[model samples]
Target: MRKSPAAKAWTRCAVSGIAAAVALSASLSGCGLPAADPGNPGRPVAAAAAAGSQGAAGNPAAVTAGSRVLNPANGRLEAVVPEVSRTVLLIGDSQSEPVDGWPRLGLAAAGYNVYFCGRGGTGFVSSNGATGNYIDALLRGDWLLPSGTPALIVIQGGGNDAAGAASDRQITANAERLIAELRERYPSTPMAMIGTLARGEAHGGGRRTEVDALLGSVAASHALPFVSVGDWLTRYGLAKDLADTVHMNPAGRQKLGVLLEGRLRDLGLDRKPTADQQPLRASGTRDDGPGQD
Candidate 1:
């Protein structure tokens, strides 16, 4: 197990909400709000007031539970793993498509099975051209989850909304709608948000960072524990860590996973589920320790 002395130190940070996120960003080598490129300046994003895969693998062509599968969407493959109890439901986009991706590895390190629900190019209201948005997918039964209530319901996405034509208000409205539905379905379950992984202006960061802050505002409004990673690329000096214009390479993914684990500790969202949410463990899965089988 990778003991988290770093995570333990991070839990002491007073980054209670995204408001503190600005300070955190500013503190990191001047990694403050991204430079204006998408026609919007810094900090005004938060002033807008909130609006709104795969894993484990070592395979490409194979389609196992922890491998890539054809996305229910129109374009390429997405990561997937079967649902299990004592899990965290991650609903997000292509950024979360790697079965061995950032948040999945981070959350697994935090001690929980993960079940992903969204695919590439999708967000709260934005679609991947074929599959519906997060809310629409849930309503249309495009993404099915396990029967039992999971430990936590984490809503993560914003890149698609930011990149696509959806306005901030539309993103907020759809996000709220999705949250309302999730609250109805899992009343006792706690929820959280992870903002978009982004870069600075020099790295083509603009609307994506803006959407990250906007989602932070939304999470703040809902009083959800939000991890604002909007400035992460520039902050962590990850310019070379990208696999593409929008996604991260394996090295970048690993580094961000560690960073995310620390943030989860900071927000006190790293604990495992309670007795009620801890149903019988699924077969072939072992609860040896945090991040371990």
Candidate 2:
């Protein structure tokens, strides 16, 4: 039987800042959650990069977080650590869940490494029967990120909320609270949002699109950069690419990943220029290259 709000996970790892290159150890604890919707297996802290990036491969799947040593110095559960500008913390659901999916593929292509806090059947307000909602889980230590600050934080999902029975008000409240919490934790880090994937009503799109728009509003309220893909399937004519009504096939995932890569680039979410360094391209194959699982 299928259960709503099933997957919950977070990956932890730390790399020194480029300018400083000072190595700092961070302790992270998160149990892997299988992506329940499609029954995808869980992935630990994985690393992907272009040829010249960290891993030194054309398309290396990822180097799990196991490769790193954790420091129990202060013993804070989710202690504060230094910022690594090349890493991104991603929270998502089925449309592009995690470990392997369009969002991961796209972000990899954009030259950013990922530390995913992904879960299927989970969303802002839609609590997974197994893991609770996003905000509560983070607060209660259900999911703990690496001690260090990531370059950017991205919240990606709304399918669960759209499918869930939670009211719009509840969703907004939870989303707002999560954002505020993250802001407090990583005040200097940039944040972005990837809205719910939808086909639009003409193609049987329902509350998914509505929730996408609602999330967009929420992101805007906080001045968070947002990407709206509510009408992507219909707009991009990817109907044939869908494995079913909602999920996409491998080809679709690649296409969507490419689309997302460009979108993130345009939005300056992937590699926004810092005060010290000029914005430069992250290494990765522009076409037909992804460090996917």
lDDT string, candidate 1, 1-293, tens digits? 67486555344322222222222221101001222312344533222211102222343334333333333333223223444345677777766655555666566556566666766767887776556898888776566444346678788788878877679999999989998888877778899999988885556678888888889899899999999888899988876887667677666666676678778878888756676654221111111111100
Against the reference, the lDDT scores of all candidates come to 0.61, 0.60
Candidate achieving the largest lDDT:
1
lDDT of 2 by residue, 63-87 (tens): 2333221224422233122234666
Can you tell me which runs of candidate 2 are displaced by over 4 Å?
1-83, 272-293
- The TM-score of candidate 1 is 0.65
Error of 2 at 61 (Å): 27
